[model samples]
Target: MKRPKFFYLIAGFFILAIFLAGCAGQKGNEQGKSAGHPNVLKANWQDVLSQAKGQTVNIYLYGGSESTNNYIDNWVAPRLKKQFGVQLNRVPVNDTKDIINKLVSEKQAGKKDGSIDVMWINGENFLMSKKNNLLWDSFSPKLPNVKKYVNQNSPAIKNDFGEPTQGVEAPWSQAQFVFTYDSNKVKHPPKSAEALKQWVKQHPGKFTYPAPPDFTGSAFIRNMLYETTGGYKQYLKPLDKQTGLDNIVKALWNYLNAIEPYLWRKGETYPESASKLDQLYASGAVWLTMGYDPAHAANEVKDGRFPKSTRTFVLKDGTLSNTSYLSIPFNSPHKAAAMVAINFMLSPKAQIAKSDPENWGALMAIDPNKLSSKGQKQLNAIDRGKATLPSKVLANHRVPEIPAGYVDYLEKGWMEHVAKH
Candidate 1:
């Protein structure tokens, strides 16, 4: 009897231990096993949007163009106010390089918060900012507006000028190489690089590009390299030190050298900047000029900056096109507001409004199909210019691009070349 009783007691003890073990396993799952996760806060976009509703966001942008400044002030800013109660104060700078320098200084000073809210950046500036850890972390996936409204396939979303975005910046517009000519000045326009050089020679002091490091100047060099190299496959890759400069591009340099003597002001001087070149074009100092904005002439004409006789065109080869994006500083105090503003910019309504020629005249940053039916109609209405080149024009065009690696090296080489002569 005593042995049987002891056996029963042992069975009960084992059962209790098993039950407790199961309970312990259940508790572990409920609490979650990760040591670093506190599970204290919920990642919520609604909360962020609410917090940002009335906040002020300071945006730093390239202020080189008067028309752009006016558009931002007259159109984009007021809408942000009427909708979100957010106030935007634009900090205009002549050079984006200065903004980077300021950001670097702020970071070094240990001023972590309440610095800059948003930045308008692309190309070399975007790459350098991302490399230096100046930009804010990825907030794109967290925004409802981004998930539902933004066009994921647009070049703006792909990354600007071949640089990866990593969701650190929101895309705003599409820009392509646009060559504008005044019909009064030239009855026949050069359709190829070789022809352009000949035209420059035939009409000395009629053509010029911005100096190196400038957006247009750098792009022009890249375009020339692309054409002369015969293809852009190798250039689209990272530039290597071994072949830092391609001998194939010698033709481009030769061509440019030959035309420098005939360039505007004898190529001893340039228009100082891309905007100045546009001004030169408008003032009839130069018969032709290059623009990244295809509809730039339309805007200029609408605003009385360019005559109606001016027309825009692209080379037979489609132009090297890209997008511009907005980024936030790593230490932005109003990050939520910045993200909200970006989402709003990406929204269909705001995007359509921005697309209007009378407003911002910016190209849409979304796919037309994804846009609301209403948005699609708005896009169609605003995209008024001839968007394609004729077959004959296409044959003369070259898809020129600079290898990311060659950008700095080429700029340096070009500077040296300029200095020696």
Candidate 2:
């Protein structure tokens, strides 16, 4: 029996709709599941060591510091090669975004293996990569050296901004926001927002921060928000969502508005990154700079990047503290090797070496007391700049970090307000 014309047309239309829907669903599924596929080359540490014996693992690391690069080449790579027979290839990047961009490009090209073996990061970048399904999951627990040297309960073992690392990313170095000023230039530094404003007006063009999206820039903004909002003392917990946005954030905006024009470059432009801010200080363009790596300035001084008279401090308030972590890309060709690298990074010997002034001077992930006697001696022997901002100063001055979500929101808002203007 032949169907009526309308019935035939409706049947054809329905069939086409179903087929299109199925295709759309398949695409969505593929996109969702792309970050996970057993076909991806992952191996246990021993297996990876065997496979990579004399092979190279491209380690994408932030390369702003010459000492850090040297550490990788002279120290980390040599040790890995000597012990594990793995050749480490350092792919230095100025920003973690570079790696993210590369991973994205690789994904777009459908290149599955032989990509970046390991990357160093933490905070928003880690979350962004994880949320986008850009990184491997739960490989931290499987490293050959996971059981050694690290205390899983420490803040360093966790992700930046209080995010759960979930063993997807291995913990690397600890860092804190440190404020540094030229002792010869600024005899008495301002200790608070009100004081800082007066000081900035007195010393225009002598202070500036790295632009936002850089960790230090965002950290400055976070500290300002914390102080103005009076919620800094409680920053570790999730923010109060029940509070009305306007009511809670009103003071913060007001504080920023008041201080915006007074910032170096007259609120117009900011240094591109924290390292550039250090350069600005070295050039006498800015008297002050901040770094997430607390010992950064000291390292700079030791290397002649800054005057030896330059000293680091926190505000009368404590400096912002956070950890930088190592994460594995979901498509990492050698997951086990990446894991081994991260684990090695967390070892006491590595941490101590990383903290030396000639090195990166990043704080150790493990507690100082838990370190071996030699490790403690090494940690103590390092000057780490004088801790002039005493425990009381830090305790009383400690401000809260904004919710992680607010960081991105504020960046967009700050751009729209300041950048567009």
Count of clashes, each model:
5, 4
Best by TM-score: 1
What ranges in model 1 sit over 4 Å off? 1-42, 151-156, 241-244, 383-403
For each candidate, the alpha-carbon lDDT, in order, equals 0.72, 0.70
Q: List, residue by residue over 1-421, the lDDT tens digit for candidate 1.
A: 3577889899999999999999998876544322111221134766666667777888899886665677678877888888887888788988887888889989889775645789888787888897789987776666666677676665346655567788888777656776888877788888678888889999988899998777788788777776666656666656553463556667767767878999988988876678889889888889898867666677777778876778767755456766677888877777777877777777888777776666666666655568877767767666544432332353244353443556787778777776356
> What is the alpha-carbon lDDT of model 1 when measured against the actual structure?
0.72
Model 2 TM-score on a 0 to 1 scale: 0.81
User: Model 2, 1-421: lDDT tens per residue?
Assistant: 9779999899999999999999999886674343222322355455555544555667898887787788888888888778766778899887888888888788778787636888887777777787777887787666645556667776546545767788877767666666888898888988676788788888777877777877778888777666666646555555444346546665666666666677778878888788788778889888888876666677777767888788767766555666667778867766555655666777777778887756566666656667778877777676665522332344354443444666786677656655665
lDDT of 2 at 72: 84
Each prediction's Cα RMSD? 9.2, 8.7
**Top lDDT prediction, candidate number:** 1
